[model samples]
Target: MEKYWNWEGNYIGVRQKDYLTACDGIILGKFYGKEIYDQNGNYIGEIGKNNRLIKNKTKENFRRPGFSFYVKGTITAPFKSCDPYPMIPGYEDFLR
Candidate 1:
Protein backbone atom coordinates (compact mmCIF):
# COMPACT_ATOMS: atom_id res chain seq x y z
CA MET A 1 0.00 0.00 0.00
CA GLU A 2 0.97 3.60 -0.47
CA LYS A 3 0.55 6.48 1.97
CA TYR A 4 -0.35 10.10 1.26
CA TRP A 5 0.45 13.41 2.88
CA ASN A 6 -1.04 16.87 2.70
CA TRP A 7 0.81 19.91 1.40
CA GLU A 8 1.80 20.95 4.89
CA GLY A 9 3.30 17.52 5.46
CA ASN A 10 0.64 15.77 7.44
CA TYR A 11 -0.41 12.23 6.73
CA ILE A 12 -3.88 12.44 5.25
CA GLY A 13 -4.79 9.24 3.48
CA VAL A 14 -3.72 6.10 1.62
CA ARG A 15 -4.44 3.74 -1.27
CA GLN A 16 -3.82 0.08 -1.95
CA LYS A 17 -0.84 0.41 -4.27
CA ASP A 18 -0.90 3.86 -5.85
CA TYR A 19 -0.90 6.85 -3.55
CA LEU A 20 -1.95 9.22 -6.26
CA THR A 21 -4.99 7.22 -7.23
CA ALA A 22 -7.42 9.80 -5.94
CA CYS A 23 -5.36 12.89 -6.69
CA ASP A 24 -6.65 14.86 -9.62
CA GLY A 25 -3.61 16.50 -11.27
CA ILE A 26 -0.58 16.01 -9.07
CA ILE A 27 2.16 13.79 -10.45
CA LEU A 28 4.00 11.95 -7.68
CA GLY A 29 5.80 8.69 -7.08
CA LYS A 30 6.46 6.69 -3.96
CA PHE A 31 10.13 6.01 -3.29
CA TYR A 32 10.27 3.69 -0.36
CA GLY A 33 9.12 4.50 3.17
CA LYS A 34 7.45 7.86 2.64
CA GLU A 35 9.63 9.72 0.19
CA ILE A 36 7.59 11.37 -2.58
CA TYR A 37 8.71 12.96 -5.82
CA ASP A 38 7.00 15.41 -8.09
CA GLN A 39 6.56 15.10 -11.86
CA ASN A 40 9.83 16.84 -12.59
CA GLY A 41 11.63 14.88 -9.89
CA ASN A 42 11.64 17.36 -7.03
CA TYR A 43 12.05 15.89 -3.59
CA ILE A 44 8.98 17.24 -1.89
CA GLY A 45 8.62 15.50 1.43
CA GLU A 46 9.04 12.46 3.57
CA ILE A 47 6.52 10.89 5.92
CA GLY A 48 7.17 8.50 8.75
CA LYS A 49 5.57 5.11 9.21
CA ASN A 50 3.43 6.70 11.89
CA ASN A 51 2.22 9.17 9.30
CA ARG A 52 4.10 12.18 10.60
CA LEU A 53 6.24 14.54 8.62
CA ILE A 54 10.00 14.26 8.74
CA LYS A 55 10.67 17.97 8.87
CA ASN A 56 14.37 17.81 8.14
CA LYS A 57 13.82 16.12 4.83
CA THR A 58 10.66 17.96 3.80
CA LYS A 59 10.36 21.27 2.10
CA GLU A 60 8.64 24.09 3.89
CA ASN A 61 5.20 25.01 2.55
CA PHE A 62 5.86 22.94 -0.52
CA ARG A 63 3.10 22.58 -3.07
CA ARG A 64 3.28 20.77 -6.37
CA PRO A 65 2.85 22.92 -9.45
CA GLY A 66 -0.32 22.45 -11.50
CA PHE A 67 -1.79 20.75 -8.50
CA SER A 68 -1.93 23.59 -6.03
CA PHE A 69 -5.68 23.74 -6.14
CA TYR A 70 -6.08 20.18 -5.01
CA VAL A 71 -3.52 20.70 -2.31
CA LYS A 72 -4.99 23.96 -1.02
CA GLY A 73 -8.61 23.01 -1.52
CA THR A 74 -8.87 19.48 -0.19
CA ILE A 75 -5.64 18.11 1.20
CA THR A 76 -4.41 20.96 3.34
CA ALA A 77 -7.57 22.51 4.71
CA PRO A 78 -9.13 19.47 6.30
CA PHE A 79 -6.17 17.81 7.94
CA LYS A 80 -4.06 20.78 8.82
CA SER A 81 -4.87 20.72 12.48
CA CYS A 82 -5.18 17.00 12.94
CA ASP A 83 -2.64 14.85 14.70
CA PRO A 84 -0.12 12.93 12.60
CA TYR A 85 0.30 9.88 14.78
CA PRO A 86 -2.86 7.95 14.02
CA MET A 87 -2.36 5.42 11.29
CA ILE A 88 -4.69 5.86 8.35
CA PRO A 89 -7.39 3.16 8.11
CA GLY A 90 -5.70 0.38 6.21
CA TYR A 91 -2.30 1.23 7.59
CA GLU A 92 -2.99 0.15 11.12
CA ASP A 93 -0.06 -2.00 12.20
CA PHE A 94 1.60 -0.99 8.95
CA LEU A 95 5.20 -2.12 8.50
CA ARG A 96 4.81 -4.33 11.53
Candidate 2:
Protein backbone atom coordinates (compact mmCIF):
# COMPACT_ATOMS: atom_id res chain seq x y z
CA MET A 1 0.00 0.00 0.00
CA GLU A 2 1.59 3.25 -1.14
CA LYS A 3 0.63 6.54 0.46
CA TYR A 4 -0.73 9.46 -1.57
CA TRP A 5 0.22 13.02 -0.84
CA ASN A 6 -2.08 15.99 -0.96
CA TRP A 7 -1.58 19.29 -2.78
CA GLU A 8 0.34 20.52 0.25
CA GLY A 9 2.68 17.56 0.05
CA ASN A 10 1.18 16.03 3.21
CA TYR A 11 0.86 12.30 3.09
CA ILE A 12 -2.82 11.49 3.06
CA GLY A 13 -4.46 8.25 1.90
CA VAL A 14 -3.22 5.07 0.29
CA ARG A 15 -3.90 2.83 -2.68
CA GLN A 16 -4.14 -0.73 -1.48
CA LYS A 17 -5.03 -3.64 -3.67
CA ASP A 18 -7.90 -2.23 -5.76
CA TYR A 19 -9.25 0.04 -3.05
CA LEU A 20 -8.37 3.53 -1.91
CA THR A 21 -7.57 2.90 1.74
CA ALA A 22 -7.12 5.38 4.50
CA CYS A 23 -3.86 5.42 6.35
CA ASP A 24 -5.74 4.15 9.41
CA GLY A 25 -6.57 0.97 7.51
CA ILE A 26 -10.17 1.79 6.78
CA ILE A 27 -11.31 0.95 3.27
CA LEU A 28 -12.16 4.22 1.62
CA GLY A 29 -13.14 3.19 -1.86
CA LYS A 30 -13.21 0.11 -4.03
CA PHE A 31 -12.66 -0.62 -7.71
CA TYR A 32 -15.49 -2.14 -9.66
CA GLY A 33 -15.33 -2.83 -13.39
CA LYS A 34 -13.13 0.28 -13.79
CA GLU A 35 -15.14 2.64 -11.60
CA ILE A 36 -14.31 3.64 -8.03
CA TYR A 37 -16.82 3.42 -5.20
CA ASP A 38 -16.71 4.93 -1.73
CA GLN A 39 -16.79 3.04 1.56
CA ASN A 40 -20.54 3.29 1.45
CA GLY A 41 -20.42 1.91 -2.08
CA ASN A 42 -21.39 5.15 -3.74
CA TYR A 43 -20.01 5.80 -7.20
CA ILE A 44 -17.30 8.23 -6.17
CA GLY A 45 -14.53 8.62 -8.71
CA GLU A 46 -12.28 7.19 -11.32
CA ILE A 47 -8.67 6.88 -12.37
CA GLY A 48 -7.76 9.86 -14.48
CA LYS A 49 -4.83 10.56 -16.73
CA ASN A 50 -1.39 9.91 -15.26
CA ASN A 51 -3.12 7.40 -12.96
CA ARG A 52 -4.55 9.97 -10.62
CA LEU A 53 -7.59 9.46 -8.40
CA ILE A 54 -10.22 11.71 -9.93
CA LYS A 55 -13.38 12.18 -7.93
CA ASN A 56 -16.73 11.73 -9.59
CA LYS A 57 -18.10 15.19 -10.24
CA THR A 58 -21.62 13.84 -9.78
CA LYS A 59 -20.87 12.06 -6.51
CA GLU A 60 -23.42 12.70 -3.81
CA ASN A 61 -20.91 12.39 -0.96
CA PHE A 62 -17.19 12.19 -0.33
CA ARG A 63 -14.60 11.13 2.22
CA ARG A 64 -11.74 13.07 3.69
CA PRO A 65 -8.19 11.90 3.45
CA GLY A 66 -6.49 11.12 6.73
CA PHE A 67 -2.84 11.06 7.75
CA SER A 68 -0.83 7.96 8.53
CA PHE A 69 1.76 7.16 11.21
CA TYR A 70 4.42 7.99 8.63
CA VAL A 71 3.40 11.60 8.37
CA LYS A 72 6.30 14.04 8.74
CA GLY A 73 7.05 14.18 12.45
CA THR A 74 10.16 14.76 14.51
CA ILE A 75 11.87 12.09 12.45
CA THR A 76 10.57 11.58 8.95
CA ALA A 77 10.98 8.39 6.97
CA PRO A 78 13.98 8.36 4.66
CA PHE A 79 11.84 7.74 1.58
CA LYS A 80 8.07 8.21 1.42
CA SER A 81 5.87 8.54 -1.61
CA CYS A 82 5.42 11.87 -3.43
CA ASP A 83 2.51 11.63 -5.79
CA PRO A 84 2.91 13.97 -8.76
CA TYR A 85 -0.71 15.02 -8.78
CA PRO A 86 -2.03 16.62 -5.62
CA MET A 87 -5.06 15.04 -4.05
CA ILE A 88 -8.39 16.16 -5.48
CA PRO A 89 -10.51 18.82 -3.84
CA GLY A 90 -12.98 16.13 -2.89
CA TYR A 91 -10.59 15.21 -0.07
CA GLU A 92 -10.92 18.59 1.62
CA ASP A 93 -11.47 17.37 5.18
CA PHE A 94 -7.76 17.09 5.98
CA LEU A 95 -6.79 18.95 9.14
CA ARG A 96 -3.16 19.45 8.15
Evaluated with TM-score, which candidate comes out highest?
2
RMSD of each: 10.0, 8.2
Summarize candidate 1's per-residue lDDT along 1-96 as a digit string, tens digits.
445554344434444343332233233433334554444445445565445434333243454433232331113222233443543432222120
RMSD of candidate 1 to the true fold?
Answer: 10.0
lDDT of 2 at 52: 48
User: In model 2, how large is the Cα lDDT of residue 56?
Assistant: 52
Model 1 residue 84 lDDT?
37
lDDT of 2 by residue, 1-96 (tens): 455443444454666666656555565566674456654556666555444455555554544343343322222232354545555654432221
- Candidate 2 to truth, TM: 0.46
- Those runs of model 1 whose alpha carbons end farther than 4 Å from true positions after fitting are 1-11, 16-29, 55-81, 84-96
Q: Highest lDDT: which candidate?
A: 2
Q: Clashing pairs in model 1?
A: none
What shift in Å separates residue 30 of candidate 2 from its native position after superposition?
0.7
The alpha-carbon lDDT assigned to residue 33 of candidate 2 equals 49
